[model samples]
Each structure stands twice: as C-alpha cells, then as structure tokens.
Target: MISLARKSILHEWRRFAPAIFAIAFSGILLVIQAALAVGIFSTVAVYIEKSDAELWVGFPGTPSIDQGRYIPNRVESFVRMHPDVARTEPFSWAGGVWRSRPGMGDVSVVLAGIDSRPGSLTFAHAVTPVLRARLAMPGAVLVDIADRDKLGVGIGSSAEINGRKVHVVGFTQGLRGMGSVNIISSLATARYLDPGLQSADEVAYYLVKLRPGADAAKVQQALSPKGSNIRYEAWTAKDFASRTTHYWLFESGMGTAFGLSSLIAVCVAIVITSQTLMAAVAASIREFATLRALGAPTSHLRGVVLQQALWVGVAGLVIAGILSALVLWLAKLAHIPIALSVPVTAGCAFLVLCVAVLSGIAALSQLSKADPAALLR
Candidate 1:
C-alpha cells in the first residue's frame, strides 16, 4: 500500500511543485526568525555565565542591569561587611558616541565602567589576565570586537567620548547590551567622560561574589537595610541571566517582531497547503469516483489524499531545513545572534506535518460529494 501511494504522489509532482515550494519557503522563514530570537537570548545567558558572579546587587525597581539606578559606593563597603560576601565590585553603565574616523562623525557606543581592582571577580573571570592588566591603567578601555569592526577602531587607537580622550586597550569578543556596542573601562574614566557622573554614592550597581557554601538569600537579607537608596536582590548567575533574557524577549519590541514574523510564516504555509490540497482533490475526483464505482471504500480515498499531503509535508520540511541552515550560517558569518537548536528545528518540522494533515482533511470535504456517474461525464 505504501509503495502504491508513493507511485501516486510521484505521478502528481508537476501539480504539487509550487505548493511544496511555498510551504518550504514559509517554514524557512519561521525557523530563521525563531533561531534569531533564541540566539539573542542565548548571548545574554553566555555573558552572565562567563562573569561567574553569584549575585547581582542593583537599584530597587530597576527592570534590568542596563536600566538600574546608581547605588552608593557605601553599599559596596556595606555588602563586603557580610561574612558570606567574598568580594564586592561597583559597576557603571552609560551610552555615548565615538568618532567613526579622525573627523568623520560619531557613532553610538555603550560605556561600561568597573572598578580598577585586579582581584575583582567580575573582572577576573570575565577578562584574561593580560586584558585585565591593560584595563587597570587609567584612560584605557576595552571595546567589543563587533564594535571594533563597525567603528573601524583598533587596539591602541584613540577615540573621543563626549569630547574626552579615551584609548582602546583591548577587545572583548561578545560584550553587547540591548543591541549596542559596549566599551569597558575603569570607573574613573567613565566618570571623566560624563562628569555629572555620581560616584559609588551613585554607582550603577554592585556585583557580589559570595564565599563558598554561603547562602545568597541569607546574605542578601543581612545586607538589605544598609541604605535606603539601594535595594538588594540575590540571583544565581543562571537565574539572573534568565531574567535578562526574559526581559528582552517579553518586554522589548524584539519579541513582538519575532512573533509577527512566525505568525505570517505559519499563515502563509496554511494557505498554500490548503489551496494545493484542494486543487489536488478536485483534479482527482474522477479517479476517486472510479475507485468508488469499483467498490473502493471512502476510507481508502481519504487515506490516499492524506498520503499525498504527507508527501508534500516531508518534501517541504527537507527543503525548509536546508534553507534555514544556510540562513543560520550566513547569520554566523555576519556575527548576528542567530542559533538553530536541534529540538526547536525538529519541533517545527513536526508542526509542519500536523498542519499538512489538517489542511488535507479540510480538502477531503470535496471527496464526499464525488459521484461516479458525474465524474465519468
């Protein structure tokens, strides 16, 4: 029976080609969009994991580390007072522009400032020893590799930030924030670039590394009442990263764009599948009627239509998978955050099959009205 069904599908390839292509194109679009969204979220996760800090202490009501309020430098000292706290470091964040060339113009850049201490865990774990050494120097900055290429700036290059001289000392591979280029430098340098800048009394936040076997929640409670200007929250590195990912996926416009693209892909696939199956059924009405005239069961006719749908689905899935892979590779080359997970790709293929079956079933309604005598005419 399967062999015969295969023969039938082969016989109708000319009629099915356009439909197959349509479905495949739709699937490719959906997969690519999904991969891009997943990639962006994963980048944040990787950044936090690399930092290896146990807890992030930020301002109260701050939605994300990027938007957090400045904490008093005293907060860091206070947090360090806790026995469970192994080390505490102040982190500052700001945005500015760097000249594209000697006098070309200025392009946007994210400025992240951390304390110059070599023992700081956030710095120690996030950067190499050589880079850390370079960062310790005043006026030195680290630029993300992506920004380096985009801005055409190289290590040892000089750029002006808010009219203040800044020198690039090193480069970070994947340091980015909400789609902006990030430059890491000392807290004092960041303040120099923007003097209205508040010091530890107004530092962006504190990154705390806890002692081994210490409870983060207990440590957080112990440090909670130290200052009214600050609120302490404790999160495992993974949890904090997850929260950051969720913030972008759910709260940012990126989520909406991804969802709309996926919806359009699915809708396009459905329309193409439905129309193709309907046309196939209409053209085969005579064949279906002849079978009925020869005592073939309605169930048999249904099975044949369904098998055709399955064939279309399988072919489309293969094509779509290939196209998606090509797009993912291009994204990688372009350095865009786009990832294709095995489970996600597989799940999408399964969904395509289900959609095909449902579309075929809808087309089956035409089969119910076929009359042998009329088909013969």
Candidate 2:
C-alpha cells in the first residue's frame, strides 16, 4: 500500500510538492519557535543549569534564583553537616549599575559572585578554569561575549559597577541573562561591589555539591531544616532549575505569548496543508474513480490517500530537520540563544506528523468526488 502511495507521489511530484512544502514550513516554524522559547526561558535559570551543584540552598520562598535574597551565611555550615554533602560554596547575586561609555548611559547589570577556586560549582559549565583563575584577581570580572556590546565593554576594558572600578578579564559564552547584563566576579569582589546588599555575614544562595552516588533529592530533603527556625530552603538542582524556568515561562505571562504564537503556527500549517492536499486529491479524482470501477475497495483507496499523506509528512520532516539545522547554525554564529533538546525535537516531529495526518483526513472528503460515473464526464 505504501509502495503504491510512493509511486503516486513520485509520478506526480509537482502536484504533491505544495503539500510537502506546507508541512515542512510548519515543521520549521514549530521547531524553531520551540527552541527560541526554551532558550529564552532557560536564561533565567542559567545559574542553576550551568552549575555543577547538586543542591541549591537559598532564602525561604525565593520566587526564582534571580530574585534570591540573602540567607544566613551560617546556612553553609548547616548544609555541610549533611553526610552526603561534599562541599558548599557561597554565591551572591545583586543588581548593579554599569557605567558605560560616554554616549551610552548606565546599564542595569547583575553582579554574580562565584568562588574563583580551582573547581567552583557555579557556572562550571560556562566558565573555564582559566577564566576562574582570572576572576581570582581583585577587580577583575567576566562578561558574556554576547553582552559585551550591550554593556559597552570588551576584554580588558575598564568599567564601573556600582561606582567601583572593574575590568573585564575574560568573556564567557552562553551566560547572558534575561533582563540584565551579567557581570561575573569573585566572591570578594561581589561583596566589594555591593557591600550594602552583599555583606560578609550573608549570601544570596549556597551551592551544594554531594558525594558521588548520593541521591540529590534525598539530600535536599535531609538538608532542608524543618520548623519555624527554617530561614532557608533547599532544592535539588533539577528542581531549582525547573522552578526558575517555570517562573519566567509561566508565572511571568511570557508563556501565554509563546503559546498563542505556536497555536497560530499550527493553525496556519493545518490550513495550508489541508488545502494543498485537497487540491492534490481533487486532481487525482479520476484515477481514484478508475480504481473503484476496477473493484478496488473504497477502504483501500482511503488507505492509499492516508499513506500518501504520511509520505509527505516524512519528506517534510526531513527537509525541516535540515533547514532547522542550518538556521540554528546561523543563529549560533550570530550569538543568539536557541537550544533544541531531544524531547523538544521529538515533540515537534510528532506535531508535524499529527498535522499531516489531520490534513489527510480533511482531504479525505475530496474522495467523494471519486465517482465511477465521473470517468464518463
């Protein structure tokens, strides 16, 4: 049955091209939009996702990691007491005003205080060992390569954070923040830059690394202090990352915009795909009628049409994959944050197939024109 369908498509390639293109276009839109959406929201949790910490300890009721407040510095000692914990590191977050170049005014920036020790947990994925070594120098900071122009600074360029002089020692890739430029520096520098907010006795959060083979969830639960004296909360790394992404994605109302745009993409794809498939079916009505006249089952004819749709979908998906790859490559070169995880890519493929099947079902009504007597006309 599929071979017959393939033969039909191959024989009249021009007639089926539009339907295939429509499906491919739809697939590209869905996949690219999904990548952008995930990428944008993922920035909100970069601190969590890019780190090697197994658990995050922060103030109770912290809405998101970016909004973290100072929890007692003593919380580090409490977390370190856990048998599964290998180490705990203090992390600091505070808003700062970046003094840009002459024409550019002050820019809002986030001061990220991370340990510059050899194997710091924070930003372990994005920050290299060499950059960590540079950060160990006082008044040295790191900026995302993507944010250099926005903050009006480059490698070795001097700038001021909260009126304190600092120089960009290096640049990190894929460390851009959602709202503010991120200026990464050592823990002591962060405290020096924002002494009022980041004091010696307090830190915005604590990053916890567990011993090998320790279950993060179990350790997170065990470290979470119970009762009223609980001034802080502990979350497994995955859970904390999800929490931060969810806050920006759903709670912040951006998800609605993304959802609406995706719906529109699907609707457009379905409309165009169904119309093109209907036209193709209409063009082949006489062939269908001849098959029916030859005693072919109506069910068999329907199956052929459905199989054709499936083939179109497969072709379209392959094309879309190629196109999406090219687009992503270009986006990377342009320093755009767009990511496609395995699940997201798979979901898009499933959606494309569903659209193709639905278009085929809609085109099935055109089969009614396949009247045996129509051949006489």
Candidate 3:
C-alpha cells in the first residue's frame, strides 16, 4: 500500500504539490506561534531562570517575581542560618522612570538590584563576572542589549532613573522584561533610584545558594517553616521560576489569548489542508476507478489514501522545520524573543501529522466518486 501510495504521489506530483505545501505552511504557523508564545511568557521568569540560586525567599504569597514586595532583610539571615546553606544575598527590585537624555521620551523600567560581590548567585548565568564587577561601581547600571534603542542609551551613556543619575556600564543579552525594560544595577544604585527601597531593613527577596550535596527542598523547608507566624515563603529555584511563568501565562489571562490564536491557526490549517487533499484525491478519481475495476478492494484504496497522507505530512514537516528555523533566526536578528524546546518541536510535528491524517480522512469522500462505471463515460 505504501509503495502504491508513493508511486501515485510521484506519478501525480503536480496534483499533490498543493497538499504538501498546505501542510508545510500550516506546520510553520503552528511551530512559530507556539515558539513565540512560550518565549514571551518565559521572560516573566527571566530573573529566576537566569540565576543559579538554589532557593528564593520572598514575601508571603508573592505570586511572581515582579509582584514581590518588600520582605525583611532578616530573611537573608534566616536563610543563611541553614547548615546546608553556602551563602545568601539580597535581591531588590524597583520600578522607575528612565530618562536617557534630552529629547528622548521617558520609559518605564524595572530595576533589579543584585549583589555585585564575586560568586554572587543572582543572574550568575546571564550576567558575567565582568558585568557583575562593573555593576559594583556606584550608580552604574546594565541594560539588555536589545533595549539599547528603547532606552536611548549605550555603554558610557548616562541616564536618570527616578531623577537619580545612572551610568550604563555594560550590556547583557536575553534579559529583556515582558513589558517594561529591565535594568540591572547594584543594590545601592537601585536604592538610590527608588526612594521606597532605601529602607535598609527591607528587601524584595533573598537568594540562597546551598552547599554541594545538600538538598534544596530540605533547606527551603527549614528556612520557611510551616506555621501561622510564617514571615516569608521559601521556594526552590525551579518551582519559583515555574510559578512566575505560570502566573503571567495563566493567571494573567495571556495564555488564553495565545491558546485561542493557536487554535484558530490549527483550524485554518485543517480546513485548507483538507480541501487541498480532497481536490488532489478527486483529480485522481479515474485512476482509483481503474484499480477498483481490476478487483482492488475499497479498503486497500483507503489504505493507499492514508499512506499518501502520511507521506505528504512527512514531506511537509521537513519543509516546515527548515522554514521555521529560518523564521526563528530572523526573529532573533530582529531582537524578538522566540524559543523552541525539543518537546514543543516534537509536539508540533505530531500535530502536523495529525492534521495530515485528518485531512486524508476528509478526502476519503472523494473515493466514492471512483466508480468503475465512470470509466464508461
């Protein structure tokens, strides 16, 4: 059956080309849509994801990192007191107006105050040691390379955050915020920029690093004991990152919007692909009738149709993978956040194959027109 299906597709390449193209294009849309949606929401957890901290201690019921409020600086002491803890650092956050220069409009920005000391765990993955060293300079700040134009500043350029002058010392990549631009600075700079965070006893959160071979979950439980008098909450790095992203993606309603758009794309793809396959099948009705007249069973012909659909799906998926890669590269060049995970790519390929199979089923109606009597006409 597969051999017959392959031969038929090869013999009628022109007839099936549209079906293949439709499947390929549809695959591209679905993959790209899923990538963009995931990438955008993943940014909501950038701080937690980009850091090497084993645990995060923050205000009770802090749904997400951005939503975190002041928790007592003593949270750091409590976290550090754990026997398995290696070190702890205070992570502060503030929102401020960025004034790049005269004539440039003010932009809303979120300031992340991180420990600039050597071996700091906060953003250790994204912010290099040199960048962290630069941040140690008072009033020096770092911004994502992608946001240079938006903030109207570059290295050596001076900007004002909440009317306090800040110098751009360096740039980092993949640190862009979901909505507002993200600015990285030392704790002192962030405090200076936002008067509200100047209270030395209060910080937004505390980052914890545990000794090698120590269990993070155990330490988290120790730091944030279960009791009615709990002052703060402790979260494993992985759990907090997931919570942060989940809050923005689902709790904030963005996931519903993205899901609807993706569903629409799938529907559009199914409709176009099914119509194309049906037409291709219809065009080959005479050949099918000839086979039927030669004692070929209808089930065999149906298998041939399904096999053809599978081949079309495979071909289209190959083309879509190539096209999606190109699109993702272009998006990167444009500074758009788009990422594709292995699972996501595999799921998308499965969906494309499912679409192809469904289209083949829809095209089965054309088989009814393959009557041997039609040959007499």
State which candidate has the highest TM-score. 3
Q: Pick the candidate with the highest lDDT.
A: 2
Error of 2 at 251 (Å): 1.8
Q: Number of backbone collisions per candidate, in order? A: 3, 0, 0
Rank the candidate models, highest TM-score first: 3, 2, 1
Rank by lDDT, descending? 2, 3, 1
lDDT of 1 by residue, 1-377 (tens): 45545677788788778768877887787788788788876665554566757777776655555666666666677678888888776778777877746656677776777766666656556677778778777789988775667777888998788778888888876565446677788877887776657553577767788889998777666666655644555555656777877887889778888898788778778877878888878887888888888898888888888888888888888998888888888877776867677898887888788777777777788897667887657
> In model 3, which runs have C-alpha deviations exceeding 4 angstroms?
none
lDDT against the true structure, each candidate: 0.75, 0.90, 0.89
Locate the minimum summed-lDDT window of 10 residues in model 2: 194-203
Using TM-score as the yardstick, the better of models 2 and 3 is 3
| TM-score for each model | 0.88, 0.94, 0.97
Q: The CA-based lDDT of model 1 is what?
A: 0.75
lDDT of candidate 1 at residue 242, scale 0 to 100? 76
* Residue 243 lDDT (model 2): 91
